[model samples]
Target: MSGGVDSAVAAARAVEAGHDVVGVHLALNRMPGTLRTGSRGCCTIEDSNDAWRACDRLGIPFYVWDFSERFKADVVDDFVAEYSAGRTPNPCMRCNERIKFAALLEKALALGFDAVCTGHYAKVLRAADGSPELHRAADWAKDQSYVLGVLTAEQLEHCLFPLADTPSKAEVRAEAEHRGLSVAKKPDSHDICFISDGDTRGWLAEQIEMEPGDIVDETGAKVGEHAGANAFTVGQRKGLRLGRPAPDGKPRFVLEIRPKDATVVVGPEKLLAVEWIRGIRLSWAGLPPAGAEAGEEFACEAQVRAHGDPVPARARVEPAGGDPASGGTAGGDPADGGPAEGEPADGVPGPVLHLTLDAPLRGVAPGQTVVLYQGTRVLGQATIDAATALDRVG
Candidate 1:
C-alpha cells in the first residue's frame, strides 16, 4: 500500500473478496522524512504509518520492506544518468518496471504468495487461452496503464489491480471513508518522491556537475548562456535568460541539449514538432503482436508521457544492423549494444521499434518512454532513442 486512499480502499476490497491479503509498503528511501510535506512526495514515514493503520483496520498483516538500495540503484541513479546524457526520463515507470513488479513480485512468489496486488488503475484480462492481457481501467482520467506498460507477459500473471473497475478516484476515496480508513482524505503524492522539496533542477544540479555553456539558435548564432545545460529541458521557455530575443520578437524554447560540449539549442516552437520516433530497449506487457516478430508494420497508438494523449500511429520492428558499440543513437539504452532478449544471436541489434505518428507531437525528447496500445489494451513500450521532425523524415 502507498499509504494513500486508493491503496487503503484496494486492500479493503481484496479482504472483502475473501482472499488472503497482506499489506506491503515498500520503504524506498534510505532516510525518509518523518512527515509528509503535503502531496509533494511519497514513501515517507507518515505514509508507512498510514498503511499500517489501514491494514490493522482490515484485520491483515502489514510489513514495510526496505528496498532503498535497490531503488537508489535502479531509479535514482538512472534518473541522474539520463539527465547527464541530456535525456528526460520517467522514474515512476522505472520504479514500476524494476522494483514493484520485478523485485517485489519475485520475492512474493518465492514466499509462496499467489500474487502481488496493488492500487494501480489498470486491468488484467484473460484471453480464451487463459493468457493475461493488460488493458486500460474503466476510469480514463485515472488510468495508469502507461507507466505499467513495461510489464512482460509473465509479470502480468502475478499482478492484480483492485481499482480496475472504479469509476473515478473520488469513488476510491469515498470507499476508503466508508471503510473508516484513516488515509481516506490523504492527498495524493506528486512529483518525484525522492526529491521531497520538489525542486528537480536544484536536486539534479547537486548530483550532476554543472558547467556554464552557450545557448544557440537554429542559425548557429549564440543567443545567451546557461549555468548548466543539463538543467534545461525540451520545450522549456522559462529560465533561458537569453539576452537577445528572436528577430520576430517571438519567444524561443529549448529544442535540444548537447551534453558532450554543454551546448543548449533554442529555436521557435515549430522546431519541436516530431513526426517520427525510434525507440530501443523494447518491452511488451504480453505476447508480441502478430507480425511484430516478423518485422511487418502494424497500426497502433503511441503515448509518450504518462497522461499524454495517445496518437494514431504505425509501428514496425526491423533489424538495426551495425556494430552495437557504434550503432545506437544518443539517449539509447546502455544495453542496446547486446543482442535483444529472445532473439537469435547474429551479432546484430535484432530489432528496434520505429513509429510514424499521424500528427506532430510537440517537444518529444530522447530518454522518454513511448507506450504502445491497440484500443484499450497495452501492446508494449520502448525507451525513445531519437525523434525525427516531419521535414527530416524523407
Candidate 2:
C-alpha cells in the first residue's frame, strides 16, 4: 500500500472479496530523520502510518519492508546515471520494472504469495488463448500504463491492480471516506519522490558533477554560458539565459546535450521535432504485439512520457545490432531512401524497436520510454536510445 486513499480503498475491496490479502507498505527512504519533515514527497513516514491504520481497520497485518538499498541502486542511481549520460529517464518506470515488480514480487512469491497488488490505475485481461494482456484503466485521466510500461511478460503474471475498475480519483477518495480512512482527504503528491524540493535540475546538479560549458546554436556559434550540459535536457527553452538574442529575434530550444565536450546545442523550436526514434531494451508485457513480426510493421499509438499524450506511429521489430555492413547509426537518418533502410538490409528483427511516427514528435529525448499501444492493449515498450533526423520544417 502507498498509504494513499487509492491503495487503501483497493486494499479494502481486495479484503472484502475474500482474497486473504496482507498489506505490504514499501519504505523506500533509507534515512528518514523524524516522524515528519518539510519534505512532502509521497514516500513519507506519514504515508506509512496511514497505510498501517488502514490495514488495522481492514483486520489485516501490515508490514513495512525496507527496500531502500534496492531502490537507491535501481531507481535513484539509474536516474543519475541516465542524466549523466546525457539522456532523460523516468525514475518511476525504473522503480516499477526493477524494485516493485521484480524484487518485491520475487520476495513475495518466495513467501507463498500468489500475486502482488498495487493501486496503479491499469487493467490486466486474458486473451482467447488465456495469455495475460495489459489494458488502460477505466479512468483515462488516472491511467498509469505509461509508467508501468516497463513490466515484462513474466512480471505481469504476478501482478494485480485492484483499483483498475475505479471510475475516477475523486470517487476513489469518496469510497475511502466512506470507509473512514484519514488519507481520503490527503492532497496528492507531486514531482519525483526523491527530489526533495521538486526542482529536478537543482537536484540533479548536486548528484551529477556537472562540468560548466558553452551553450551554442545550431551553427556551432556560442550563444550563452551554462554551468553544465547535464543539467539541461533536449527541448528545454527557458533557464537558458543566453548571452545574446537570436539573430532571428525568436526563442531557442535545447536541441542536444553533448556531455563529451560539455557542449549544449540550441536551435529553433521546429528543430526539436524528430522523425524517428531508435530504442533498445525492448520489453513486451506478455506477448509480442500484433503484426510486430520481422519485416512486418504495424501502426499503434506511442507515448514518450508518462503523462504525455499518445501519438500515432508505426512500430517494427529490428535486429538488435544492425548489419555490420550498414556501417552504423551515429545519430543520423539513413541516406538510403528505400524501405529496407528502416527494416535493415537483412530484414531480420532484433532486440531494438524502430518507431516511425506519423508526424514528427517534439521533445523526444534519449533514455525515455516509448510505450506502444493498440487501442487499450499495451503492445510493448522500449527505452529510447536516440532520436535522429529532425523534421527541419517551419
Candidate 3:
C-alpha cells in the first residue's frame, strides 16, 4: 500500500466488496536501517507502519515482503545502465513491468491470490469476451496509465486497480479521512523514491563513472566541455555552460549524447523535431488488432512520456532487424560488445514499431516507451529504438 491514503482507501474499497484482502507492503529498499523523512518516501519504516495500521483498522492481515534485491537488480541497476548507454529510461515503467506485475504478481498467484490489486490511477474493464481491457483513469489529470503501459496482455488479467473508479486524488484522500485513516492528509511522494533529493544527474554521477568529455556543436566543433556525456539527455538545454553562444545568439538544445565517443551534441531546437519513431520490445496490453499484419497502418494517439500530450500518429508493426536493436543511434547496447545488465540477452529483440506522427514532435528520446491508444482504450506499447527527424528521413 506504500503507506499512503490512496492504497489505504483502495484496501477499504476491496474490503467493502467482501474480498479477503491482505495488505502487503513491499520493502523495496536495501538499506540496512533507515527512517522515512517526512512524506518523502515509499519504502520507509513510517510508511510501513502506516500500512500496518491501516490494515489493522480494516481487520485484515498485513505483511511486509522483502523485495529489495530484486528491485535493485531490475530497477536501480537498469536506470544506471540505460543512462550510461545514452538512453532516457522510464524507471517507474520498469518497476511496474519487472517488479510489481512480473515479480510481485507472480508471487501472489503462487499464494492463491486471484490478482494483485494496487492504487494506480488506471482502469481495467472486461471486454465482451471477458478479457481485461486497460483504460485511462476517469480523472484525466491524475491518469497514470502511461507508466502502466509496460504490462503485457497476460499480466493485465491478474491485476486490479480499486482507484480506477475514484473521481480524483482529492476524493481518495477525503474517503481516507472519512474512514479514519491517519495518512489521509499525508503528502504524496514526488521525487523518484530512490533519489531522495531528486537530483538525478548528481545521484547518477556518484554511481557511474563520470569521465570528462567534449561538448560540440552540430558541425563537430568543440563549444564547451562537460564532466560526462551520460549526464546529458537528448533534449536538455539548461546545464550546458558552453564556452560561447551561437553566432545568431539563439538557444541550442541537446541533439544527442554519444557515450562511446564521450561527446554531447547541441544544436538549434528545430533539430529535435521528429516524425518517425522506431521501437523495440513491443508489447500489447490486449489482443492484437484483428487481422493486423506487418506494414499495415493503424491510427492512434502516441504518447512518449508520462503526462506528455498524446500526438496524432499512424503505426505499423515492422519486422525487428538492423541497427535499432544493436547500435547506439537507436539507444541499444553499449560499445563494450555485451548486453547491458537488465537488457534482453544479445539476440534479435521483440517486434519493432514504425510510427509516423501526423505533426512533428520535439524532444523525442530513445529508450522511452511509446504507448498507443484509440480514444480512451490502450492499444499497445513499444520501447523506443530510434526517432527520425522530418528532414533526416529524406
- Runs of candidate 2 exceeding 4 Å displacement: 34-39, 290-293, 323-350, 389-394
Compared with the true structure, the alpha-carbon lDDT of candidate 2 equals: 0.81
Question: When superposed on Cα atoms, how far off is each prediction in RMSD?
Answer: 4.7, 3.8, 4.9
- Report the Cα lDDT for residue 50, model 2: 84
Model 2 over residues 86-149: C-alpha lDDT tens digits?
8898888898998889889999999999999888999899988888888899999999988888
lDDT scores for all predictions?
0.86, 0.81, 0.82
Task: Write the residue-wise lDDT of candidate 1 on 37-115 in tens digits.
Answer: 9998899999999999999999999999999999999999999988998989999999999999999999999999989
Off by over 4 Å in 3: 321-348
Per residue, candidate 3 scores C-alpha lDDT tens digits across 284-329 of 8887666444446688999998898899998866444424423422
Candidates sorted by lDDT, descending order? 1, 3, 2
Better of 1 and 2 by lDDT: 1
Worst 10 residues of 1 by lDDT: 338-347
Clashes of each: 0, 3, 0
Residue-level error in angstroms, candidate 1, position 271: 1.1
The candidate, 2 or 3, that scores higher on lDDT is 3
Alpha-carbon TM-score of each model against the true structure: 0.93, 0.92, 0.91
Best by lDDT: 1
